[model samples]
Target: MNIPKWILDVFYSYLTSELIYFDGEYPIATPVATFFNPTKNSIILSTSVSFYNKVKCIKQNPNVSILYSKHEYSGLSEKPVVLVHGSAKVHEKDFEKNNAYLSKLIEEQKETWKKEVYIKMGRELDSFIGRRLMDWYMLRILIEIIPDGIVCWKKEANILGSVDDLSKTIGSVKGDAVFAFMGEKYPIGIPVKLRKSNRKFLIENPTLNLKEGQKACLLIHSHNKYVKEITLTRYKGRISRISKTSRISRISTREGEIGEIEFIPTSKFSFKQGGILNSIRFILDGKRRAKKFLERYKKT
Candidate 1:
């Protein structure tokens, strides 16, 4: 792989177990759901990876094709991480059964993931999503194809798209998104309310093709516009109002203290509105912003 091992590790470290599938069909997902959260909320793309097709794709359609265009021949393709680029299958009749089986799969995960937590004075998991993932799970899916290839990117390299606007790790996202790409600038998604039974959140006329099985990148934006977030490439969405917590546990069991352990959190934020949004992309420009990010990493 052209990218460094540590850089690869950093990229993988940011991957939250959730899979972000891509497709162009309209959604056949469960209705929208509302989740509660108690924390302030808070995401890039580049081109040194691949210049031609990305520009081509962006110019071709500007939305669906552009996203696919970047993936057509990315610099990340030179890396070692396995890239499973293909389609997934959804078995509606099997959804309930799959959910039941997944419960067992989760129970099995407990053996490996089980860990004690010492919530800060007034913190509880329920305050987030409670125990059950109410909005999703019932929608059944089964990937029928395998990944076409493997890929990666150098976190420290300035080869891909504009590095300036991409956020490192400080974004929170809620709602659905419609994507579009411009020139060499990274592809952008316009956040919209996840559609559900309730019709409350007001969104303008949204564009872009999305479906239940297709994949999309979720960029969680921080309340502070300055700090962006690492991208979460997962299926368009798993559940609504998803709680993505930084589980850096400072355990104080019967023992005095056990220090801190960081655990990747889940997120599926919700909103009472839906539709298009008129908004600015984010952050610095290409060359200068990339220089700024390179400096920040140097200090660390």
Candidate 2:
């Protein structure tokens, strides 16, 4: 569904006062000069020409996510909080007023930003804007986020903060997934909402010292304080891609490994062919063996 402009307007309002966190190969939490271009239907990230690792990583794998709040959870007041999942595309080139879609957005973005400038910069506001525009024409990189999904809340922040308010909070499903690769383990938090839909999980660079073409096993144990411990085992696959601090590279899309890795959260079943059935069968077979072993030995 096309996002209504009002939602875009709300997101745009936070761009100046609140900051957003960019998570991909690395996690960056910094105040950004950002604008939402209605034409491109995306949020634009502009920075100096010197390529940040993020730029290279986006090119390697476009999957990216961002988080933001009116306050950095610093206060208990309800305010706009958003989580954005999107694809990031990097652009590097000499800037022109009409060089690309970005060039057009820059001119329009400036108009809206100018009013707030005087309020922030005082007497040097004009000079500041001029310098900023000139810098835009210099060598630079742009990261445009085409949002896939968004979660926003304005009044739930305080409720989410308390441990005792365990109504919806306690009811929310969450899990800890551990992935073993390269002789180390990665503990990832899986929200209840994403357990069924999340197929690809990202392990940040240097986290487990992961590299391209490496093999790994993912163990999803979705049992938190609110729910029973359900350990889903044997989600295995080779490293498909890795986002280094410098750049990202693809490892594989479809591999020949059967029962190597699997993601079947519902009913222990998947409809896709090509060894998909074997993994489910394996899981069921493993469960039967474990149940028999428990009944014969540990049941007493």
Point to the candidate with the largest TM-score: 2
| lDDT digits (tens) for residues 76-168 of candidate 2 | 233444445566777654344323554455446533333243233323423665454333223356777787655444434222211221122
C-alpha-based local distance difference test score of model 2: 0.40
Worst 10 residues of 1 by lDDT: 34-43
Which candidate gets the maximum lDDT versus the true structure? 2
Q: What is the C-alpha lDDT of each candidate?
A: 0.25, 0.40
Candidate 2 clash pair list: 236-261
Go through the candidates in order and give the C-alpha RMSD of each one to the true structure.
Answer: 22.8, 23.2
TM-score of each: 0.26, 0.40
Candidate 1 structure, TM-score to reference: 0.26
Native-to-model Cα distance after best TM-score fit, residue 251 in candidate 2, in Å = 44
Candidate 1 C-alpha error for residue 73, in Å:
30
